[model samples]
Target: MSDNTKAYLHIYCAKNIIVDEQKFSELEHIKGDDLEDVIKVSTDKHIVTANYDLPSNSVFNSRIKAKDISISCPLLEAGKHYVISIYEVTPEVAATEESTFMDYVHAEEIEKGYSICLYRKK
Candidate 1:
């Protein structure tokens, strides 16, 4: 498959969570069409941003390891928590295009010491 066809996976965590191979492997099975739909709907309704969306025509999939959420997101921090989400986006949508403070327009508490916040960065 072409690069576009290959899924882009990202990892983010909330405050010093030990992430190891086992954690990553545990998350490997979490990606699929069903999870993608949940992410799409949740992001579309909650996140308020014009540039925030998953790449359309490209597979939108993700998984979580430890307290980190892994998806095709940019500007992810290793010790910060984020809610896994998806949104239809153009294939050419550069990750940098949405990397701005204003683009981070939402935040919500998900788990103790873990909160979901909009992020756009490398």
Candidate 2:
């Protein structure tokens, strides 16, 4: 991939990931110890992080997974769809009539159960 090409790294099997500031700031939790930590956003890396204090109803989701709740829909390409394994993320849920979060995600197929994914934007 060219240096100019943007990469979405989302690994979930590592520690102290070396991601950019936006990625680190996009962490699902850090709101409260009583909140549920779930995968919610896409980043340059696949190494997702979350605590076990998230709500039981909210799960990090994407359109590719359930189509019910997923912000990653914009990440999907037109004809170059690759199978990546998406881990289950249960984050804090919104109270309004419309939830402000994507709390469910499923990978069509993952890299040996790994959480790293790379797809060109279409």
Candidate 3:
């Protein structure tokens, strides 16, 4: 009944900041409690920041379509733990945020040369 691919959904768990991306798929069915907090949108802007647990705070840029986000920063180096967040920021959220490098390969656009979803590891 929808043409869009659901990428992100879970505001309650994300609110207390307990939801972990590594277990993102587990949150898919998370519901019945404070789930209404989830941000519903035709479009939204978000950022993916990766922390390699190093003194240097270097991050790579990536984007997500709609209000849903799914990305794992692959900057893991030896002897380091990586942490990333998909922050739903305000005051700076712009229409251009949806226009990103990853948008081209969004799940819905897969047949149109955005076939990168297969390597996304779900």
- The sequence of per-residue lDDT tens digits that candidate 3 reaches over residues 8-118 is 332322322223333324333334344422221122333321221112222553432223333322222222211222333321332224532222112222122221121
Clashes per candidate (backbone, < 3 Å): 5, 27, 0
* Cα lDDT computed for each candidate against the true fold: 0.30, 0.28, 0.27
lDDT of 1 by residue, 3-106 (tens): 32223222222222112222333333233333421111211122222112222232464533333332223433333323333323322332323553324433
* Superposed model 1: Cα runs more than 4 Å off: 14-23, 26-102, 105-107, 111-114
Query: How close is every model to the real structure, measured as TM-score?
Result: 0.22, 0.20, 0.19
Candidate number achieving the greatest TM-score relative to the actual structure: 1
- Residue 121, model 1: lDDT of 26
Model 1 TM-score on a 0 to 1 scale: 0.22
**Candidate order by decreasing TM-score:** 1, 2, 3
Q: Can you give the lDDT of residue 57 in candidate 2?
A: 35
So what's the TM-score on candidate 2?
0.20
